[model samples]
Target: MIACDNLTKRFGHFTAVDHVSFAVAKGSIFGFLGPNGSGKSTVIRMLCGLLSPSDGHARIAGFDVAREPAAIKPLIGYMSQKFSLYDELTAHENLNFYGRLYGLRGAALRRRYDELVGLTHLAPYLNRRAALLSGGWRQRLAMACSLIHQPSVLFLDEPTAGIDPVARRELWDLLFEFSSQGMTLFVTTHYMDEAERCSQVGYIHLSKLVVCGEPDDLKQLPVVNPPDTRRIDVTCEHVTVGLQAVRQLPGVRTATVFGQSMHLLVEASLSEDFIRTELARVNIPHADIRPIAPSLEDVFVALTNNRNGET
Candidate 1:
């Protein structure tokens, strides 16, 4: 339901977003992933009509961002990083105000208010002031406020930041629930676990999207020598020496030290006997060897680090 063409944004001599282009399918949750200062927020703002692009163009729900911002504004809901709600207003009051802003009134406004309260699990707190709510409650309140008008598209910028893991999971469940009901979500998050939950993810770095695909597809991107395919944990007197010795062994791709132990990534065909023989040659006491699936964090780190080196 969203599309961008060579989108660019600049302030003075620095470009915040550089010729980035991507599309979000209707009813899909598209995760925008990046480190600090990677322009995820800038792009989001531009798409939401809160900011104008310096170059290129974009459309939301088939309306041009620049030429038809007003028509699109009411069709999308935006929840910024900051909690944007009146602290003194009760949960019901806050939604009431937002509903009015969208031209909802009387029974319509009351119905939406009650529906949002129920969806966000804030029914019990309907009479509680926003400021009195805890972080998780405030977050849910903010989300409810954003959806008060039942917009077709939702823009969430780090909505789960600073919340506990359990709260984060609950919030994600809510997002998936909304998505299942046909609401398109455009979210920006630093957490890899959340990124993995998205239907598709765009990995941004240095104002550019380095990769965009499903989480598993991104993970399967070609790695050097298939990532050595094995991990060996060893505890030795000299971890550094053991690492260096492992690096020299055949089939060993990389050896990294983790605390007092070293993790070796070696070819799958290499047997424990061969690894033990290599350790014996270096007089490094060995501990154990096992296989583990590579995580999303591992793939992300590898891609970003490799990109940094290239630059």
Candidate 2:
């Protein structure tokens, strides 16, 4: 239940967000993807009433962000990239403080505190000071504090940044749990895997949203065809030589190394047999050769690099 129409934010002569518009349906996790300094956080702040937009307007749960900011504040919770908890306070104490700020007190505060502690698995460290907690623990505590008031809408700005893979996955699981309970999650993340997990994604580039749709829909956007510009992953001991050879081959448009493997953008006319025969002739020992689906990162790279020619 979130909507924005031509939302724009400017600072003097510079525009941070330019005419970005999108809607988040109830119970959906809408992922906002962008690189550093792409104005994602700026747009999020404007949507949450933390920053007034220089142009246009946003409505959250039916309340106008510009004219009725106070009305919307109580219905939403925001977790910023930075840890927003008292370093000296215990986990329980931090939750209590935020609960009080939201007007929760006595039994109500105690109940919410307990619920959040359990939900975020903070019981074991309830008496631990925030500064003493690990990064992952601190992140969980911050998320718990934000939800203590039980707001219907949650805005998470790079919530999983710098956390370990396991921790990030756990945090995503918690977000999906909240969505299943009818909470709307508007999240901005740098991780393509995380974006793929979202119900829908909005890609921001140069202060504007260049793409918005389901992850698969965005991945399927047509690109310039070398006819055979298919992606194939191959693992070989001689990755450097293999890449060079593949790039020089007819029907092969691009060959790049990804870790220990190689990703080839080849023509559709390049059959599996042809590829195998070429590798065999070169005496290259490949672990595997098969077509691989393009990831969100691949689509993003293609889209952002050559927008003029995209379909």
Candidate 3:
């Protein structure tokens, strides 16, 4: 339902989105990921007809991004990172305004408003002003407004940014509901766990698409494990301090704190006894240290490092 054929975009002398290409199947939730300024948003704009690509093009719901930019707008929905839904208006009023802007009138507008309210479960907050609603409620309101036109394809750029964890999960539930109904969802997020929920994921780096595939396939990539190296998850007290201590040890290629645990990409020859000995020497209290599966974050870290020649 969505395709990018060598999509390229430029601004003045700077190339924003390089010749990136990927396809999204119908009813699938595709995750777009990258560091800041990696052209994730640039590619979204080009696909949504908000920006013109300097070279190549994209298609949404079978409409050419370059030739039929206008035609594509009506076929897709876009909810930007900072949603511009009116703050002074109530949730219902905001949807009503957007519904009208999308050319729904009278009976059609009312029907869509009801459908969106039911779909997003915004009925309880319908009369509440957007500014008065909580972060989660506001996000749902923005999502409803974006879908006021009932577009088949939805583009969400950092939709869960700055929201609480519970709110993020709630929003993802809605995304899953949309995908189950045959609506194509393209979402960009920095949260690794959120990317895991996507059926397909595309990783962008330095304005180029470095890798694109299913989460399991990405996790199993040889680039992640490399040669003579393995990954281990170590849960230790004082996680921040433990990270500092563990990173200074030999054979530890990469050490990062994840929640209450620490992930280390270390030399496989480093024995568990050796790690325990080293941590104990520094008085860093640890619960358990064991080899573990590579997570999505590990895959991206390895892929990005390899792509940038970081070894």
Candidate 4:
């Protein structure tokens, strides 16, 4: 439902999105991941018709984004990062306002309002002012307002940014529900776990798209799963100490502390016994070590480091 061919955006001498291109199949959830100021938002703005591309082009459902923005607008809904809402208006009033803004009125407006309220479970806070709602509730309200017109595609820019864990999970649940109903979703997120949930993902850095594919496929990329290398996880006390020790080992390519464990990339010849002995030297004995697969974060880290010519 979405396609971009060498989409480029420039501001004077600076390029924000450089020759970026990707496609999103209908009913699929495409996660766009990148660091701050990496041009993720710039691409979204260009695709949404809010900003004109300096070169190349993008299309939504076969309609040229730059030339037929009006036609595309009716086919897509956008929920920005800020949860755009009228602070003084109650949830119910806000919904009505957006519904009218989309040209819904009378019976039609009432029906969509009810559907959104039920979907977002905002009925309890219908009379509550937007400013009075909590972050989670405010996000739901924003999502409901975005869906007031029932567009086929939804663009969410970090939809779970400031909410609690429970709220984040709940928001994703709604996204899954939407995708199941054949609604295409384009989401930008900083969370690795959220990216894993997407049907396909694109990682952008330094205004360039580094990689784009399914999570498993990206993990299998040779850049990530290097030849003659094996990934392992070590669960032990003083993980930082274990990490430091393992980093100095000859065959250990990368060692990073993850929670109470350490994830390491090492040569296949680097046996677990060798790692255990190294940990023992640092008084971190009795470690539980096991082989593991590369995670989405690992894939991006490997690709980013490779791009920067780092070992």
Using TM-score, give the best candidate's number. 4
In model 4, what lDDT does residue 208 have?
A: 94
**Every model's TM-score:** 0.85, 0.91, 0.94, 0.98
Cα lDDT computed for each candidate against the true fold: 0.85, 0.87, 0.89, 0.94
lDDT head-to-head 2 vs 3, winner:
3
Q: Per-residue lDDT of 187-234 in model 1, one digit per residue for the tens?
A: 999997899899989988899987787888876777622644755566
Candidate 1 vs candidate 4, lDDT winner: 4
lDDT of 4 by residue, 52-119 (tens): 99999899999999999889988989999999999999999999999998899999999889888888
Candidate 2 segments whose C-alpha is farther than 4 A from its true place = 224-228, 238-241, 248-250, 254-256, 272-284, 308-311
lDDT of 2 by residue, 260-300 (tens): 98877788778877776677667885557878887777777
Using lDDT as the yardstick, the better of models 2 and 4 is: 4
Best by lDDT: 4
Residue 184 miss distance in model 4 (angstroms): 0.5
